[model samples]
Every structure is written in structure tokens, then in C-alpha cells.
Target: MSLAALINQLADEDTSALKTLSLVIDWVRPRPQETIASTLTRMEQLEAALTESLDVHLAVSSRLQSWLDNAQFFQLLSGLGLYSRRGFFKEISERLYERVNPAPADRNNVKDVLFLVFNRKGDDAWIHEVPDEALLKLLGTLWHFSPPALERTRIRVCTQILNAIEMLSIWVAAEELEPNILRLNPRVVDRESAFVALQRELAAFVQSYVRGLQDEDEIHLDHDHALVLIEQCRDEIARLQRRSVTAGSTMALTHLLERLSQTLTRIEHLLDILDPADKEKRTRRSIELFKTLVQASAERHGVRTLWRDNLRLMSRSVAENASDHGEHYIAGSRREYLAMLASGAGGGLIIAFMALIKIQILQLGLGKGVETLWVSLNYGLGFMLIHMLHCTVATKQPAMTAASIAEKVEQGEHGRANARKLAELLVRVGRTQFVAILGNVAVALTVAFAIGWCYTRLEGVPLISTNRYDYMLAGIHPWQSLALMYAAIAGVWLFVSGLVAGYFDNRAAYLDLAGRLRQHPLLRRLLPLTLREKFASYVDEHYGALISNFVFGVLLGVTGYIGYLSGLPIDIRHVAFSSADVGYAMSVFIPGVEAFAMFTGFALLIGGVNLVVSFTLALNVALRARGTRISSFPKLIRAWFQVVRENPLALLYPPADPRPEPLPDNHPHPEAAEAGQPPSDVTDSSPSTEGNR
Candidate 1:
């Protein structure tokens, strides 16, 4: 049927209004090509015809009054029990949908219903002039003729129409009399824009409140005034929602509601915090609450929010990579502990040789630019080779293993039992670290001492200049030098390297590095199938480790030269190299046993600082990234005491018979296995590109 005929039948027929309305919607909904202007014209004509055909003003009021006389409809709508109402709404909605079944895909029944109800904007002028009885009847009619109670789209439209009339009714009652001319109110536009601005002010209020609560500062604001303002803003938003029937209006309404809810919740929390309590307990309570809020903000507003899902991928990938490195730090039995010591000794031997090569590189007397490049290459290539050799640098273990520890902590909920497990892990890490340091230093000093003696015998002079030897001794003097601070700085670099490694590893897995490499045009055209596959697999597994090592080398290589150029005391202090330097100094410069003893003690102090700073920073970052909190520092200390008390030997020596331990969680998340642990891989990713000294 034609839309005009459908509308005429709906308005003129004495049949059920609901049935007539449904027939109109089913007839006129699908006109996707219709323009806004044409639609408005058609709707105006229908409204005029409908008004002439049916005495809408008088009949609608009486019909609405009669229908609502018993108040049964209100009971059905607002007070109906949940279970009964669901079925009631379902029956009404199904009857409507069945009439409109086999509807065209592009047909929008909700828009049609809205058009029929609000055929002309001028028709709403009657709402302001009508008496209370007529007004109430008009609202009831709008509700009764509402299309399909369960159709959310249509319901939303109907809500706006009713809400608009309700608002106009309120406005009319407030003004009492009306003028002939319709003039725009500048205040209305200003008020609406101000309402939007108030949303921003409300957000700022939340932030300021949080900050004030944290700092124990006074946040003086009249709560009643704020509440009144929020209500007004809400009212303005409702007005806007009704005036517009577009997706933009819907989104704005939704956003404003969310902000209002969040702001209200925050204000309540702030009030709770500001309430007077015990003096001793108040600060602690506030601090704990602030920490929780900060963590939530970090998760929501920080970098994690931009790539929340990706970080989960990274955490899993890094945890997997760390698990491989972690296994190397753990000794299965006494035999394995001894084997780790041997491996550390081998690592120390290589470092001593690297130190000797560095001295030769310095002696070449190249320009600063060439020297820097050569030194960078010397350290970068040396470290990468050391990693390939499967040896362990004592300081490097912390940066690599921290992720594994964090992952395990994340798997379990916070409790004394979990703390005990962490304590046990710490004990193993401690013993392993001590043994590795012992092996590295003992071999480094011996090998460097041997090299110095051999160079003296071959060249018939001191292997290193006396000035260079003296400078090394001065660098280690704790009080007289910046050695400890430099060690801490190196520790920061170690932490950064760990993050860089994790980031690259995340990229490899996420980007499907191996598959991409194999499918590359150059590789596909030039390489043998087996070789290309092998190369791709190698890069997929080891790219992060390899890149991290090289970058770390470059950072260490240029630091001293950069320090000289910039007139800063910035430098790195690695324990193995420091030990090697001390050994060389002992052979070439130290004249007495007492002097040698003092320098050796100083060197060990530097090593201790390096290990402590790097481990602490790396562990803190990894734990935070995994969202794992240790609960309390005192609890951790207590757990450590308990672990040591139960098995004193576990701290000093490896267990005689090691058994397989169960994974932390019953349904552990599976992670793909990555590459092995590599030594000297802890380097700062950012470094100056300037030449070395």
C-alpha cells in the first residue's frame, strides 16, 4: 500500500490504534533513498491530514484518561515483578515483530514509528497549552502507542519524544504565559555550552581530589553545590538528547552518563578518605588507597591502555624467554651448582682476554672517532660471541631472570605461602649468584695476573702504564670517587636492556618474524630452502638477545669518552672487568700487600653495588608490569627467615637430591619456548653515537 493511504487508514480508522500504527510502520519503513527534506514534508502533510480526520486533541486526552483511570497500566509498567513482566513485554514485542516479519533488510521500523508520532514539530505546541488532565492523557497516549516494548531502537526514540514533551510542559508551567513571536534565547545556547564545559570541570575535580587526598592536603568544596550542578548538567544533557535523534546525541548522552557515574564514585571515595580517624592509622590507610587508585590509573591511562592486549602478549612472551634464562640460574643438584661455577670460570677467562684486547685497542693511538667505533665493535662483537659461547656474566643473570620470577608471582595470589615460594626462589638465586661471582672473579684475577706477567716477560717492561694502573685504583675508591653511583647507573642500563629484550621478543612473536623472513622476496629467490628456513628460525628465536647485547656494548663503549667530552663523571662498572682491572693493577702497579688488599676490597664493594642496584630495578619493573604485588615488605622478610630457618643449607649450598616441583598454577598458561640465556647481554638501548676515547 502507498504510504499516504497507510497513514490515512491509520488516522481515520476506528480500529485498534496499536494495530493501525503497526500497519503504517510495515507499509512505509523502507525508503532508503528518501531525502530529509522530502521526509519532513511528507510527515507534515500526514500530521495535517491526521488532525483534520481525527479530533486528536480532544480524543487523545479522553482516551488516555480512560485507559489510565484504574492506574493498572502504571502497575504493569513500573511495579510489575521481574519474571512476570519479561513474559508480558515479550508477548507484546513478538506480536509487533510478527506483523513486520519478512521486513526488508534496509528497513528501519524505529525511524518510521518516530516519524508517525512526531510528524510535525508544531504538533508539540499543544503540549504547552493543554491542561494537566489533557497533558497527562497525551503522555499516556505516547506510552500506549509505543511500538514493541522490547524494541530498544524504537523505545529510545519514544523516550526522547516523551521526555521532550515533559520538558516543554515544565517550561510552560514555569513561564505561565506565551508571546506571539518565537524568539531564540541566547541563554539557552550559553547554558548548554556551559553544561558541556561543566563535564570537563567535573573530571578536573576528580583528579584534584585524588591528588589532594594523596598529599594529605585539604580539598574544601561544598558537596551540596556540586550535587546541584551535576543534576543541572544531567538535565541539560537530557534536553539535548530529546532535541536530537542522531547517533552523535546517543554517544554524547552515554559518555556524559559514564563521566557522571565515575565522578560520583570518586567523590564518595574521597569523602571516606577525608573522614576523621585514628592519627596513626589514617596516613597508612590513605596511602594504601592511593596506591590502588594509582595502579588502576596506570592500567587505564598509561601506555598499557593503548596496547593492553599486546602487553599481555609481551608479558607471556617475555616470561617464556625468562623461564629459559631462569633455568640456567637454578641448580638442580650439587653437581649442577659445580657445573655453573665452571661455566662462570670460563666466562671470566673470556672477559680477561677481552680486557687485554681493549688495552691494545687503546694503545693503537687512533683518533677519537675511529677509537670510539673500534671500541664499540670490540665490546659489541666480544659480548655477542660470549653469549654464543653459552657462558654466564654474573650481573647479566638478574636482568634476564627477573621476568621469570615476576611471572611466577603473578600466577599465585598474595599470601604467606606464595611469599615462601618466592623466598625459596630467592635463596636459590642468591647461592647461584654468589657462586657465579666467585667463579668469575677468581678466574678473571688469575688470568689477568698471568697475562700481565707474560706481557712483561715478552716486552721486558710493565704490561700497562703506571698512570693507567693508578687511575684504575682511584676509580674504585668508594669515598674519593663516584664508583658506587657509576655502578648504579650501569644497573639502570641493565634494567633498560631487560625491557628492550622483552620488547623485541614481543615483536618477534607478534609479527611472526620467522614466517615473514621465509616469505621475503630476496630470501625466497636467493637462498636454498633449508638455509632460508634455518636462518629465519634463528632470527625468530635470538634477535632480541642479539640486538640487546650489541646495544649494551655500544652504551658501555662510549660512556667514558662521552663523560670526558661532557665533563660528567658518568661511567659503567662491571664486576668481572673491574676484577680483571684490579688483577692487572696488582701486577703492574701495587707495591705492597696492604695496598693490594685495600684495592681488592674496594673492587668487591663496587661489584656488590652493581648487582644490588640492577637486580632491584629490574625486579621492580617486571613485577609492576605483571601486576604482581608482594603484599608487604615485612611479610617477605618473615618468609625469607622461615625459608632459611627450615633449610639453612639451601642458602649456602645446593640440595643433594633435587625433585621436580609443580608449576605455580593448576591451569598454567602455556607459553612458547624461546632462546637460551646469553651473557654480557645487559646493555642500555639508548647511547650516544659519538666516538670513544
Candidate 2:
């Protein structure tokens, strides 16, 4: 039937007909088959007819005004053609609560009437196929025009309005939209629509929204997929920009271009962060971004969003454990070099003793479990003492030092000249490592040889049998045994120790462990204030390193047993300990100079593998943890070569000038001491050895 006929037939007293017409308006659903022009034409006609019909009814009867007074009538009118005048409709919302305050029952009565008008009909009401055009017109006329009290209306009213808006969102053109109009388009949908302009706008809005989506919920996107999607957006923006120049810049075109530029900038920023080739730059940005995301979680979830935010708390606490570890890497002068050397020497002395203990333990003829325990105790207690005494373990430097360097790099230390800076840093590290290793191996070999010589002199027999001495010598030879593979395994253990140190450090800081320990009731009651405070402070500073060192000892102790269980020949060969083993072999067994030289040479080579493989792995992890990446190996190698050619001694000796390296401006770590300070220690002893106790 014609819209005019429907409007003309509606009478003030014919409430059923008026209600039916309201239902007809609410039920209008848009269909894809209809053209835009035809839809708009129908809408314009229906609105004019409905408005005129409502005006005539208002003029003819007091009943129309009474119905307008009823809240239910106003709600139904909102679904029909009630308040087309935007200004007056908006005022109804402002004064609605005031009106409802005086007689809330009037509002409830209105709701009751609405319930009967719509709920009683149910799905049968939806069967009436109201024209999409008419529904669109009615929705546009009444949208957001409801009285404030109607805000609490039932879901049926909300659903009708939402359906209409969703349908309208599909038809509305971004170019034609005014900011004043309420548009519910989410701006997050994939837009491959025919409307090129709207597609760009939608993509831009979605991208902007995505950057802040933790406020909504988490979203994880594939790195490659995000890049491809961004590339498509870039192309579309360029195409739109070119067209805007030819079409002449309208206000809409200018706004669209601005959004496109902003979106392109955001896409580029994300791309820079994700690029694998740009490791240094990527890591710095990623660290900052991760930190920001973590901060936002607090803001969005309000500090302890779920379960008092234990994860973040624990990470921060664990990070604090690295403070002491970090300080072990920074060297500024000759004094620091000697300190590091002394620390290494001290560690080597203990490692030599540990090797002697291991050999004695192996001769006990105990089961593997008992053997593992004794060996662990021998290594763990020895290393714990080394750490307490502040001695050095050469391979452990990479993991802790990486975090320190990453912090420095993150403090605006990157750009075109980053390669040179990294080269300088690497040189310092190389020299420090060289001296430490020298101190360790030199002392350990000397100590082991002296111990073996003294023992043989006292007992009038060799410390190890001739057969076992040959086996130790042959084990160091790469082709005769798995020395290289075992060295690599040691390297892996070194890397793990670094990670363990970092994790515990973070945990300490996050949990405020020192303060918590100080606050313990027993400690407060039993200890003096000074002692309690000191104890807590020590734990806060040294707990992670202590735990990591002990764990590392256990790991080293179990390697052979694990490999044996798995029917493998896995073992570990560390440089300092191996050199000491070779020294013992030379003292007890080897008679020929050629044989002694080969064993010594092979032991040194095994040590080299252990240091290189472990340090390299540790460096990689540290970079990743800090969201930093090393430049390609070729680039780093070239840089190293350039530094070497300029000054060959830099990696072996301290420079004459010896400027103190500055701490990073934003360094959060608070490690207790510097390189020249008392050195920390861990054992590098292998798990097995020679003769009976």
C-alpha cells in the first residue's frame, strides 16, 4: 500500500492502528537488492507524509497531546515519526529525568504500555515487511532523540535502534558524513568495499584504534601479515593523494589525506620495530613499547588488574637480581683490570680444588645418584664461596654484560654511528674476557700441576694412574673424543646461567624482597635492626646470582649422567678446568714433549670453543630480552676488523688514557659493585676425574 494511504488511515483514537504503524517503522530492514536512489526517494516521501499526518492529528485532538505526555507514547513515537525537529528532540532528553522525578509511575506506565505493544506480538510483529526506505527515514528522524528517562528502556527498543544503525552504517558514505551525525561504524572491519574513499578512512581509523587496543582487549597479529596489510594501505593512500590533486582539494579530501598520512606514519613506526635486520634499533624501540604496554595495563586495569598483578611484580623483582651481575662487566681503569684478574685467579684456584674433589668422588665407586649429589655439593659449595668472595668466571660475563650494554644502547645510543659504538664496546669486552680467561687458565694449570707434583712426591706414587692420564689427554683431542661437542654443551650451560641470573634479579625487584624480608616478624623480633637490614639488603642484591650459580653447578654435575641415561656421549669441557686436567696429565703420565704439547694445544682449543659458543649464545639472548639485535655478523666482523687494524692491542690491554665508561642515564639496575671491586665467582670444573681417594 502507498505511504500516503497508511498515514491518512491513522486516527488518534485508533490506538491499534497507530501502534501497528509504529511496529511497521521499527521492523524496516534494509535489503541489498534496492538501489540507493530508489531507497532515498521512498524515504523522503514517507517522512513528508508521516510528519504532515502527525501535525494534522495534533491539531485535531487533545488526545494527541495526552498521548505525547505518556512516556510509552513518546517511546513509540521515537520508533515512528515523533520528534523530527533535532533541537526540540534534544531538549526532551535534558528535561526527561526532571519530569520522571515527580511521577516515576508515569514512566513505568509508559514502559508497561510499550511492553504490551511490542512484547505481546513477539516474532509475529517482525513478519510485517516494512520497506527499508521507510525504516531508514524513521530511524534517522528519531535517533538519539529519546527522553533521558528512556535510556533505561528494555532491550527490544535498543535492538531495533541498533539494527537500524548497523544497516545505515553500510549505506552511509564517509565523504558525505558530518561530524554532528551519530555514526556507529566501529572502524575496525576489513574494508575491501567499492567505496575507495571510505575504505581508506576505515583502514586509518582501525589502525589508530588498534594501536590502543589493550584498552579493549589483546590483539596479536602475525609480523609478516601486518607488514603486507600495511603495504596495501600505503599504496591506497598514495593513489588517493594523487587523485586529490587532480580533483581539487575539498575539505573532506584534505581531512582524508591527513588521516592517511598519520596512518602511514603509524604503520612505518610498527614496521621499524618489527624489522629483524634492524636489531639494535628494533630492540630499543621494542623495549620502550613493551614497557609502555606494561604501564598501560596498570592504567587500564588500575594497578593489580587481576590477582594484584603478580606477573609484573615478579618480573621487576627478578630484574633487580641482575644489579650485582651487571656491575661485574664494566671496567674503567688499570685498577679494575687487576681486580678482574685477581677475581679470575681466585675462581681458578677453587676450580682446581673442585677438579681434585671430582676425581676423588668418581673413585668412591658410588651409584650415579650418590655420585651426582657429591659432585654437585663439591661444585656448588666451591662456586658459592667464589661468588661470596667476588671472583670471576669468564664465560658468565656475556649474559650479564649483554643486559648492561642493552641498557646503554636503549638510552638514545643508537643511530648511524651505533656500529662504531658497538665496536668500541666489543673491544672493551674482548680485552676484559681475554685477561679474565688468562688469569683463570694460567693459575688453574699452575695450581693443578703443583698439586699433582706435591701429591706424587708425598705419596711416592702418581695422583692419577698412567692409563687414566692417557684417557684425560686423549679426551681433549677433538678427533679422538667429543671434546668440541662437550665444550659447546658447556657454552649452553653458561648461557642458561645468565638467564637464571636475570630472572631471579627481576623477581627480587618486583617483589621488594629485601624490604619484605626485613619486615618479617621473626627477623624483627630476633635480630638487631642493623643486622636485619643488612641481611635483607644482601639477599636483595645477591639472591639471584646465588641461586643461578648453585643451579648451574647442579646442571654441570648432571650432564654426563643425563647423556648416559639417554644412551648419548654428552659431556661438558670447560677451558680453565680442562687446562688444569691437562696439567695433571702432564705431571702424572705424559713423558714425551710432543705428546705433552698436543694435549696442551687440544685443551686450549677446547677452552676456546667453550668460551666462544657460550658467549655468543648468551649475547644473542641478552639482546633479545632487551628487544635489541646485533647487526649482521658480517657487519660486526667488519667492524671488529677495522678496530683491530687501527689498534691491535686494544683487545688485549687497557688503553693508556682509560676513560671511565659512563653508566646509561636511565639504567634501572643497581648492582652493588663495579669491575675493579671484589670479584664474584663460579666453578668451571668438569664432573669427573682420576684416582682413588
Which lDDT tens digits does candidate 2 get at residues 71-155? 3422221222111122322434543643455333342244334333333222222222434434434544433234542333322
Model 1, runs deviating above 4 Å = 1-325, 414-417, 519-527, 590-594, 658-693
**Candidate 1: pairs in clash:** 372-692, 552-683
What is the TM-score (0 to 1) of candidate 1? 0.52
TM-score (C-alpha, index-matched) for candidate 2: 0.51
**TM, every model:** 0.52, 0.51
Across residues 308-350, which tens digit of lDDT does each residue of candidate 1 receive? 4334433443544554455667765789789888878888898
